[model samples]
Target: LLTVIVTAAGLVSSELRSGSAALTLAKPISRAAFVVGKLSAYLLHLLAATVLGTALCVGATAILFGAAPLGDLLQAVALWLVYVLLLTCFIVLLSCTLRSQLGVAALGIATFIALSALSLLQPLAQTPVGMADVVTAAMAGTAFSATWPLVTSAALALVLLATALLVFQRKEI
Candidate 1:
């Protein structure tokens, strides 16, 4: 969560601060394309890091514990990836709306904490904020369905990305 917030907090604010966004916007490319390109690049970076980290952790666990449950670990990691992706979209949206990178990061962290706290409620247990519990259940090899969390997280991510694009488009740079 910190990684997502820190990385995305500077995605646009830094560009705008350095005057790079103005220069880029001066080009023929559309603002939407620029925002999407930034998001795509970050997503690729996040995916690669997640894959490499997971592989190393799994390898180490297998060596230490002798053949752990790969299915359960992978399932938990998949759910985690979905949650992180949603977080990235949200932080990106914050970056678009806020000029200060620090402000974006602070707000992102606050929001993450708030949602985590809210997840303790039974009613919100099925939301994306409760993804940590679902991930824990998966890792523990408990029987639980991850369908709703995955679907909701993905849907929220799309909404966030679209809203970010809209905000960036109208932004004065």
Candidate 2:
């Protein structure tokens, strides 16, 4: 979240706040391309960081524990990637509307927590049943069900990005 906020939203917000946006626009770059390019760069950075962080964590765990949980690690990595992508698009969208980095960061955090809580509703709804029931249900939830969070995150991210692009296209530099 911090990675996406600082890299994507922070950079753009700072550029806009410092009046460099006008200078950059004075060149021939279209606003769409500029926003997309900035987002792409941040995503690339995020991808590299995620891969490197995962490698180091797995490597360290293997060295200390003799074996690493590759399956669980991969699952976690997939979820985290979806989360980061979703948040990155969200920050970009928020940054366009909110001039303050602090405001964007605060809203991003709130958005993440809200979305996460919503996602956990499925498990919580079944909680009154018992722990065993929850675990069993989760296990039996099917592959798609198990990966529902990732799918939802991806969908939301796409929507947010599309909206951001539309807003950015009409926004004055």
Per residue, candidate 1 scores C-alpha lDDT tens digits across 22-108 of 999899999989988998999899889989999999999989999989999898988888888889889989999989999999999
- For candidate 1, the 10 contiguous residues with the lowest summed lDDT are 124-133
Please state every model's RMSD to the true fold in angstroms.
1.1, 5.5
Deviation in Å, model 2, residue 93 alpha carbon: 0.3
Off by over 4 Å in 2: 123-144
Off by over 4 Å in 1: none
TM-score of 1: 0.96
Strongest candidate by TM-score: 1
Cα shift from native, residue 157, model 2 (Å): 1.2
Error of 1 at 139 (Å): 1.6
For 1-173, candidate 2 gives per-residue lDDT tens digits of 55466656564676778888789888999777777888888888878988999899889988999896577567656655666776788898988766778888888877666654654555533222122222234334423333444455567778888888888777766
